[model samples]
Target: MASYGNDKEDYLKRLRRIEGQVRGLQKMIDDDKYCIDILTQVSAVTRALQSFSLGLLDEHLAGCVVDAAAKGGPEADAKVREASEAIARLVRS
Candidate 1:
């Protein structure tokens, strides 16, 4: 029932990739890798997650927000507010 349901598999694949990157980070730490190198990889992982979050947010706006807006009522307002809050959170992060 979620907006990302249609692309759930793709999302999962991305999450798995991110998970792998995290494991890689752990390995880098355990191996006592160079500080700069590890920091670079950490930046890469952060960017990946940010990109993923943005994609999901776009899908939510396109699917859920649009659908609710079309119906024109309190639900639509709530959806818009929910989406605004989500955006704010993303921005803060």
Candidate 2:
């Protein structure tokens, strides 16, 4: 029933990869790795997360928002507003 239901496995895979990157970061800290190297990995993880968020947002708009708009009612308006808020949050992040 969720917007991302179709691509749930893809999302989970991406999240798992990101999770591995985070664990690597922790190991880097434990090993006292170079500061710049650690920061680069941090940047990579941040970018990966941002990319994931954008993909999910696109799916929400394409699937959930589009479906709601097709129905033509208060739900449509709410979906659009909800999506707008999500975009704002993503932008702020």
Candidate 3:
């Protein structure tokens, strides 16, 4: 099963909203809007994407990592390492 199968719909909903935001941003550019206004929308979109990423990461840790760790073996170690790497990448971003 997919790691975030349960949240798949919620994720898609958020992504669609973000997609709309992106389209709005494009429109703002085409209309020759103020720099600050366009930048404000850009920041909102960035933060929304970050929030979505954190939520998915949370689910991965809670569901996938926890289950793997419960199994107690090489799979558990790999999962922990994978989760740590994911966190590192998120932090860097």
**Lowest summed lDDT over 10 consecutive residues: which window, candidate 3?**
1-10
- Models sorted by TM-score, best on top: 1, 2, 3
Q: Write the per-residue lDDT of candidate 2 for residues 29-73, one digit (tens) a residue.
A: 999999999999999999999999999999999999999999989
**By lDDT, who's the top model here?**
1
Model 1, stretches more than 4 Å misplaced? none
Ranking by lDDT: 1, 2, 3
Task: Estimate the TM-score for candidate 1.
Answer: 0.97
Q: After superposition, how far is residue 64 of candidate 3 from its true place, in Å?
A: 0.5
For candidate 1, list the clashing residue pairs, or say none.
Answer: none
Q: lDDT of all the models against the reference?
A: 0.98, 0.97, 0.95
1-93 per-residue lDDT for model 3 (tens digits): 768998799999999999999999999999999999999999999999999999999999999999999998999999999999999998998
Candidate 2 scores a C-alpha RMSD against the true structure in Å of 0.7
Residue 47's C-alpha lDDT in candidate 1? 99
Candidate 2 whole-model C-alpha lDDT, 0 to 1: 0.97
